[model samples]
Target: MVRKIFRVLLTILGVVTGFFVADSIINSNYIMNLGYFNNMVAKVSLYVFATLSFGIILFLLSPIFYKGVSKLTDAVEKSIGRLSASEIIFGAIGGIIALLIAALFILPINKLLPPKLEILGTVLSIIINTVAVVVGVDISVKRKDDIMALFEGWKKGSSKDKKGKVKGVAKVLDTSVIIDGRIFDICQTGFIEGPLVIPSFVLDELRHISDSSDGLKRNRGRRGLDILNKIQKELTIEVQIWEGDFPQIAEVDSKLLKLAQKLNGKVITNDYNLNKVAEFQGVSVLNINELSNAIKPVVLPGEDMNLTVVKDGKESGQGVAYLDDGTMIVVEGGRKFIGENINVTVTSVLQTAAGRMIFAKQKEV
Candidate 1:
């Protein structure tokens, strides 16, 4: 229905153009001597013929015009959509200022041109104004980062990113790693560097969990809070409380990854799944589990040590013990020795995705 109405309007515009063209030709000095146009009826017929000719031509081309307009409109909408509000506002202001300057610049040039060349001058002026506005808008929007950086230096919170984000190389801590309480030990040993970041969102999540109805969650949350306090007060390393957060993002894990990315830092977490997700997303992550496993003492077969069997393993006639660092040691044929200290020989060592496990046998008396 809209297309039909547009087609009619287009045809009408073509008819108006044709009428003015006919009238211009008829009144011209060169055509005044033409006897054919001198006749009133012939001139009327010529006018009608030209109007209908152009109207019919434009009517046939209406669909093409409609499609072209549609494409142009879509392209314009997409271009505008990609611009933020500030960019759009500044671009509009720049374009307007450019057009004003262009108009001022062309007025004198137009006056210098002869009357016969006035149309050429007008075309040149249009081109100049258009190019000026385009250049102005392009410069205003594309250089926004550089302009924003000039102001960012004055503001505080970490440092200035090259592209206007928080520039940091500090370690960003997650709830799991914090609550595990091993990060403090690692920091104390000088293995982890200074300026550790604790994102506000992670703190809020810790607070929520600490106040949760579930006992385990409550304990874990409170422990994380306590560990954070300990790291801040007891550790010599610099610990920063990052007050920034992604309010639009709901999940705390997702927010942690985003904060890490924005800070240009590594995420320190113990969650296996979160580590996988962070790796998949191309964000750098330092898994405390992986680090712990990497630093665990290398145990070789045929090594004998005195250890206590704490519990029975899954397999028959097996007992499980742990080293000082929590790496599990599985003892074969030592299930009866549970709750007692025993001599064990390291038979084999297994490196699994979960962690390291050592298989040992009861040593000879």
Candidate 2:
């Protein structure tokens, strides 16, 4: 029924177009001089024939038009679906502003053109409007972060009267830190402040890892996702999943640095390589490994400590033990007591970017 109605409407539009065409041709200076279209009957006959012919043609082509319209609607819907609400709002505002600016120039410009160049004026006006709208949307998209930040700052100002006000910094999370799972514990301790910003690309990488063929990678990936869920549910701080991404950047770490710079946020990760890269790029990084090292119990030389000799170290008589926090202790001349718990005196402590290592000699039996 809808198709039939649409076909009828199309036929009517075609008939109206045909009538206008016939009238224009018949009234033309050349046609008037020929004197054949002067008679009322002849003109009426011609108009009726043109209208009927166009109506029939359009009715026949209605199915093709329906298919074209359907495809167009689907394409538009898909494009709109990919745009975020903010993008759409900005785009609409941009388009309106462009049109208004175009209108301001179009009237005077059109009047200044020669009558023969009237079509040129119309074309130029259309081009100007198109260019303006494209430029506006591009600018809006590129400056979206700045615009959002301005709005957010204003909002925060309005709510300054509220008690227990905490200023939140944007803390962007990296894939490695999520997989390390220490972030969850750190958040639970209430030491870290700010809105935990998880990039969409990081989440995508995690998903890929979780679906990997290698069992170890798959487990790590899944654990990261689980940790993210725990943080979102248990932590009092805001956990935001940021949808913004930089397509120009190929590597996740590079993209993360770009995102941090854009948000004016710090990158949180346990990745040594990423930490160094961020430092070189002048981006702030909150390294989980560094944090862990800082909080580990301080060991001084001549301090007595007890540890189980779990394995032999690289040295011929060095037995390896670990502190509760996983700090390695190298016990001298204790290789014979690999399976036994022994008291050791801390001889020295070495700290590196990786972690802290304690060098000690076994206490006398």
Candidate 3:
């Protein structure tokens, strides 16, 4: 019904446009005599013919155009449906700011240029303005901290709590870090300082995942969301969900890197791949796994430690146990005593790109 209405409206519009074109052709001589038009009516009449022909072609193709547009709209809506209204509003504000900045630089050139070049300048200004606005919005959304920082200086003198001590480093908690669930305990300790940031997109992704049909993924997603709520509600530290996104960059990791780079902040994540990618891109990453490994009590080779043989390892007669933090300890010749706890001497420690591994053998202690 709406399409039919649009078609009728477009047809009426076309007919009205055609009448104007026909009148212009009939009154070309009179129009040519008008000042500031430079007797360009004959050329302008040709342009009118071109425009009318183009409009007619567009009218004929309207149905096809509508179908294509509808499909694109559906795709966009599905992919970004999780976005909240506030995020959309924030993006719009950023875009407008960008457009205004672009126009500020563009309008001067448009006004200063010669009359003949003015038309070209106007077209260029529009293009530049659009690019600036979109780019500005993208940066503002991605570097949400930078956008906030613009106004943050106004509150500098308001904080009179600590004057001379060094400030703590801010840790931007990515979604994976929160989902991993170790960060909560890490923050409970006094080691990591400053505020924690949770980007709005990360929250949206978590929410979408939590609503997924797969049981395991759904659980993990919900766990992450729950962890986020706990940090926000229970923890004493400042937890903020930053409204930031880079629409041009589809991948969340890319947005994270861009945000980290912009804010001079370190990304805290447990994702192994993201850690490597961020480092390659020159973005600083503080891997939660790495921190756990580092802070775990140092157990050197030949050191005798008490461990439990809970399960069999891949190698024959090897028993596997875990530390409180879930670090794996492999004990050779202890597989038979699966239910018993025994002392084992560390044979070697294997460190990988992801984390640390320890190998040990039954020790007489």
Candidate with the greatest lDDT versus the true structure: 2
**What ranking emerges by lDDT with the best candidate at the front?**
2, 1, 3
Off by over 4 Å in 1: 1-168
* TM-score, cand. 3 vs. native: 0.62
- Displacement of residue 62 (Cα, Å) in model 2 is 11
Q: Candidate 2 lDDT, tens digit per residue, 1-365?
A: 87888899999988998898889889999999999898999999889988998888998998999889989999999977766677788778877877888888988999899999989998999899999888888777678778877998899888773556486778999999999999988888889886899988999999999999999999999999999999988888778887766766889999999999988899999889999999999999999989888989989999998889999999898899998889999999989989998899999999998798999998766
Write the residue-wise lDDT of candidate 1 on 77-168 in tens digits.
99786566778877887898889989988999999999999899989998999999999898877665455546755664455444443344
The C-alpha lDDT values of all candidates are 0.86, 0.89, 0.78
Return the lDDT, model 1, position 287: 87
Model 3 per-residue lDDT tens digits across residues 1-365? 86776666665566567667765655588765663345568556655775677568657876876788789989989755655565566678889888878877887888899999978997998789878877876676555555566666556546654544334556778888888998888778856775787887788889988999999989999999989878777777766666656678898888888877766788999899999999799888889877877877777999988888899999999899998877899998989989898988899999876677899999873
> Candidate 3: deviation at residue 301, Å?
2.7
* Count of steric clashes across candidates, in order: 0, 0, 1
Compared with the true structure, model 2 gives a TM-score of: 0.81
Off by over 4 Å in 2: 1-19, 39-82, 101-121, 161-163, 213-215
Per-residue error for 243 in candidate 2, Å, reads 1.5
User: Arrange candidates by TM-score, highest first: which order?
Assistant: 2, 3, 1
